[model samples]
Target: MSGHDHVRFLTKNMRVDLALIAGMIAPGSRVLDIGCGDGSLIDHLFQTKACDARGIEIDMAEVTQAVAYGLPVMHGDADVDLAHYPDNAFDYVVLSRALQAVERPREVLAQMLRIGTRAVVSFPNFGHWLVRWQLLATGRMPMTATWDRPWHETPNIHPCTIRDFFILCEEEGYVVEQWLAADDGGRRTPWRRFLNLANIFGEQGVFLLRRR
Candidate 1:
């Protein structure tokens, strides 16, 4: 299918975090998306912004699906594959909803900033009030929309909060260009102005960052 057709098929189907990450990227620039399931974001970027968008997905099934749809997605792991790219190879490297799943998230993030001018990362906020409330009420792992899978079955290993991410950025000397807390319902603006409030209420945290 054409890029336009692929994008049309993906409208409203794109994850809220992916849309937010796309908005942070400039048009007509190179983009690399990690854990890019079926290359939906890449298709959207290529069709709408004229970006040279490509992706790497660990799942061979997803890689094949993306390739069938004419997307440039390779089977690769973020923990290892990112090191092969040269410095500043792209304008942006995006990791949407997959940071916590990577075995070495900090290293992956560093590699992303190394190979791209900027990095956009989005992950479920473990500090959300709903998560806390659920855990407290049930004495078990929470199961919200973002964290739906059972603890034993979930891919997330090092789930972090918005505050935790901010601290990591500070420790790594990465500049936070922009950040926001958004929900799955496509509401991107709520609680963005208040970090503490966002940590309590926001379902997820999206951040655009660059190395200091």
Candidate 2:
């Protein structure tokens, strides 16, 4: 099946970023999902890919709900608890759509790469043309599906663009194995191949990475 078809087939309720994260993972791999929300992706991975999936969410309510559904989830903060995992404990560590919200994005990514052979990270892009135009037009934050929350009500503290992330990876000596820019509709374009266009048009991005 195509990647989009696989993601669409696996989950109808998942966000586009989560679907892309799922598509990046290898089947039957041990996976750690940070900021996994209510464990929809974890559940999907376990049932569909035969993965031994576990999740860490900061929300107690979400943890409760996921536990009730028989998903292995712990109420934990990504910024604080990611350090506790031993090195190379999982095949893939995923942080989907939560990178900008984390207190220490660089630190969390370092820990993720340390604990797993591969890491999947996804987040909304602040450099989209709409955002830039909105800032220029109204001098205010733009409202899009991926970044719909108002500035006062949002958890995101460190919004970055695809270019910004690339610079961060370069500084941290991480390797970008694969990356793509996706629209809010879960459709992925050749963002990696045609990056300049993607940076302006793509609403979000997903990346598969490892340490150098």
What does the lDDT read for residue 94 in candidate 2?
91
Measured by lDDT, the strongest candidate is 1
| TM-score to native of every candidate shown | 0.92, 0.91
lDDT of 2: 0.82
Alpha-carbon RMSD, each predicted model: 5.2, 6.0
Per-residue lDDT tens digits for candidate 2, residues 39-81, read: 8989989988999999988767667888999999998888888
- lDDT of the candidates, in the order given: 0.85, 0.82
Worst 10 residues of 2 by lDDT: 1-10
Number of the top candidate by TM-score?
1
Model 2 earns a TM-score of 0.91
**lDDT of residue 165 for candidate 1:** 99
